[model samples]
Target: MLSSLVVSCSITTSELLASKAYGAAQTYPVAPDRAWKIVRAIVDTTAAVAVEERREDGVLIATTESHDWHVATRFAIWIEPVEAGTRLIVVSRTVRPGAFPRALSEKEFHRDFAQRVVGNDLDSHGPKGK
Candidate 1:
């Protein structure tokens, strides 16, 4: 009984955290600067607005409030250079309560945003040619 209770509590805590934030990282065949611009474009269009943008730190943060979902979500993105190309990391966090499911929200959030920016010509015109 004690062990079962502990397991249940752990699952509950994990689920709660998962709902609050989702993170995904991907490497693209592009320069970090180009990747940053593409990411800025995607989030500018999809996110309600960029609450904070820091180019020096290679991070951009945006927030959106949806009346339909009755929730506000923030997306934080990081861009860096890898040996082969550029790596982008995105994390979505919910700032307010809503009807969104807690268990799989982060994965869904990542899928929705990452898919929009990957495998495209937008990054082809990097300052440094590929």
Candidate 2:
């Protein structure tokens, strides 16, 4: 009976943490359409596979390949239009309970995303190749 109670508590704690959002939000100085395109590209290149993508709703859910410690990592990203620009919110969690957290952190994701967006801007304005 004691073991069962302990197991129940562990499951409850894991569920609570998994349901909570574990990412950060950043607003970019760009339109939603442009941000959406860049976000999709980023997810496609990074995630093992995109489980679902809803452009109209501005939501993308993806999963990474399993590693030795975890079954897989899941990412849920949302892009919305804000007064200043587009706001992106990224949430990552482990797919299996008790598995290690192997998903990319919010800061790392934002850094990569910012670099891509800036690179795109630069490429667009640079001199055209002959």
Candidate 3:
């Protein structure tokens, strides 16, 4: 006898960057505090130095510079309370010459944030049949 397994997948463009700024919004099925923690972790982990942080208002702004690569970027995160759960808006900008830096930042940030909230790896690579 032989057995087989099947899986399904979907892809969508939920956010895009414009005007040299990359912005994306996601709603997680978690409380505002929980979402805030995730955002804080991302900022603390990736930021070179925090330029401004407002916990009470649910906002964090950080600036980072890659000395070896000579790339400078700024990050802004906002957490908002919502009926479904928590809403997150992240915006990023690159001071150094680069293309789609903010968009790239948002993509990575969203991937990590979503995976943590859902407790699963969201690797978007095409499914591998086994």
lDDT of each: 0.53, 0.62, 0.57
Candidates sorted on TM-score, descending? 2, 3, 1
- Estimate, for each residue in 1-130, the C-alpha lDDT of model 3 and write its tens digit: 0011001101111121222133588888888877766666656556454346677866666666555543556666777789999887877666444463442277777777776676522223211220
TM-score for candidate 2, please give it.
Answer: 0.67
- Runs in model 2 deviating more than 4 A are 1-22, 68-71, 98-103, 121-130
Model 1, C-alpha of 40: deviation from truth (Å): 1.2
Q: What local lDDT does model 3 show for residue 80?
A: 78
TM-score of 3: 0.64
| Ten-residue region with minimum lDDT total, candidate 1 | 121-130
- Best candidate, TM-score: 2
Stretches of candidate 3 above 4 Å error? 1-22, 100-104, 120-130
After aligning candidate 1 to the native by TM-score, how far in Å is the CA of 67 from where it should be?
2.9
Model 1 per-residue lDDT at 53: 64
- Which pairs clash in the backbone of model 3? none
Per-residue lDDT over 17-106 for candidate 2, one digit per residue giving the tens place of the 0 to 100 score: 354355588998889888877766666555444356777767766666666644556676778899999988887665556747555656
